[model samples]
Target: MTDDVTTLAWAYLSRVAEPPCDEIATLVGEVGPLEASHRVAAAEVSDALRERTAARRDIHAAEADLNLLERRGGRLITPDSDEWPTFAFTGFGGAAVRERPQGRPPLVLWAIGPARLDEVAERSAAIVGTRACSSYGEHVAAELANGLAEREVAVVSGGAYGIDGVAHRAALAADGPTVAVLAGGIDVLYPAGHSSLLHRISNAGLLLTEYPPGVRPARHRFLTRNRLVAALGAATVVVEAGVRSGAANTAAWARALGRVVCAVPGPVTSASSMGCHVLLRGGAELVTRADEVVELVGRAGEFADEEPRPTGPLDGLSDAEKQVYEALPARGVRSADEIAVASGLAPTAVLGPLAMLEIAGLARRDDGCWRLVRTSP
Candidate 1:
């Protein structure tokens, strides 16, 4: 395996290709990066793929990117590098990501700043919300981030406006390291207006991305980027988001990755809070303060480091009951019809287990419907 060739090829591909390329990631995973790079260099690719790879095969391109990163006081963090976060296990967490449409691990990461990636990723909490957020969201995000940072926990967020921006600034104000995980190239100052905030993150905390220089942010990239933010955090907290917002997507990814997920409730009449409410109803822990977030993430991190809980991985719930319980939300409620549909169980089939679950105190019935009893689990 040619390490240098592989490294340079990953850099080259990162520039030419869109991120989270499932096919390429699978190929690289099956073969080592070196062998995969050699294959692409040899044009051992399908006709459709050859065109893309052939057009971007500049042997010198990776060198230029390296030099640029060096000048910017940054470096590449590849899977082989010690700086790579371990939580990025076996490429994109676990078996769960393979089921996703755009769910693959990043090929290479471009990083700028002082905070170590693993340390920042391991104990962090991703605080994300809508870019056009309400004051309530802003306040919640800032306070939550501040509390976490002041406790010496790293705060991670995208450097967008509203909730993300507030999260970063609050962390800094607390004199704690904050990481900005960008969707675009690390060098590209997205939102253009938040250049100063990005600058502060680069200097005082950390700035990271999978895209190479000159790559601009795209709508798909931001959605795909959610997984990185989700993966970095031991727990992910959503302050507020629209019904169909990116922050909600981040929460979904966190659930898929098995990271602890939490949601901060907001006014019922506010559309900005819909996503958070949805998440809360979907079983994410409900948190309203910075201390709550810190405790949630802290216990989660501690649990992650503990010996595997003999909760038998099934958490002592039978499959049918587990299905029914999962269908119920952490807040609000779900009707039997909804639970049946979600659990893919017939109404008749669900009735018995829901009863048993209620007896076990894992679920509670309300007005003929049911919901998961709120628990730290």
Candidate 2:
């Protein structure tokens, strides 16, 4: 019965690709609706599937693999299974099912991990960003992942390069469990370069996919998969992204689901930082350090060491100078406007203290913006 239900579900997903209701209804009709709530109008479903001829073919091919896997003694998990992830079910329920043409959730999820999906994702955060991330971006991603892991928080991300790669590596390096939700089949590492990382995650963390083995990733699938990343995590953080990058899609999905969205602020001039800045301006939490990321996850204590201590050269300065110094970030540049906002001081008051700090070599201007510089001999 599990086999039959699983096959029918896989076949249905293969048919609809992007949640087409008519195709799903047809499959549900053949499969007997597995559950009563999974139904939609056939005509509306058909219209939604009007332009997906190629996707339909891909679905058929994947169905064949499901049959092969079943023959090999592999088990299937339906929504009714005891092993089915409760958190995923919650996401399914919270998802905008009304907006989808199919009016159905995923047939079943294929997973390989020691921890149950719900347990692993009890307080998870998705770290997503560009494949071509800068060094600064990678550093921030690693710090955030490491902090989350040390706090026993699971880190979730796409198993891609740049930021994702760094995030996974940091979590693993810290001996923390992480989950990699793929756009392609779990068996097929899309970029190919991260095969080792994928293997490590399968052993130490979890590897998940909606697609069956041997299926390759398609363009639309990547966008569709982002929703899973957002839905699975308690919050989503974009370390870096281009203005129109897919990370934005994840942020949007997170927002729609009422999940906290966080972004690491980078150099204002960087093209990669543009997306994060946009997110920040749009009300996403502005995080320059890992503690800020942790705070968003309600795990601020995990990165307490990264927090600045109330001491050092500023200790010798007056209360007003200390206020100005405390206002400046530990790294990167900030305009006077930012300092004013952060310190709640007028621009006139900030200017006097800014000069005093500069003379003391505790701060310096780079490219017309002031930054807190570490004192040196």
Clashing pairs in 1: none
lDDT tens digits by residue: candidate 2, 1-377: 87665556554554345432445545555655433123321322344344443345333444565665455334344555566654332232344643553233455566666656777766788999998899999888999999889988888999888998999999999999898888876568777999899888877888777666666888877876787787777789999999998899988877765577888889999999999999999988766655555555664223222334456566678545776887888888898778876875556567888889999988887887899978753
**Which candidate comes out best when scored by TM-score?**
1
The per-prediction CA RMSD against the true structure, in angstroms, equals 10.1, 11.5
Evaluated at residue 259, the lDDT of candidate 2 is: 70
What is candidate 1's CA lDDT for residue 2? 65
Question: Residue 60 of candidate 2: its Cα lDDT?
Answer: 41
lDDT of 1 by residue, 1-377 (tens): 46666677678767655676665676677887766666777778666556666666545467788778889999788888887876542232456566564666678889889998878776789999999899888888888999899888899888999899999999999999899989888779888999999999999999999888877899988988888898888889999899898999999888877778999998899999999899988888788776666666665643334333336323777566777877887688888888887876566668988998888877888888887776555
lDDT over C-alpha atoms for residue 70 of model 1: 86
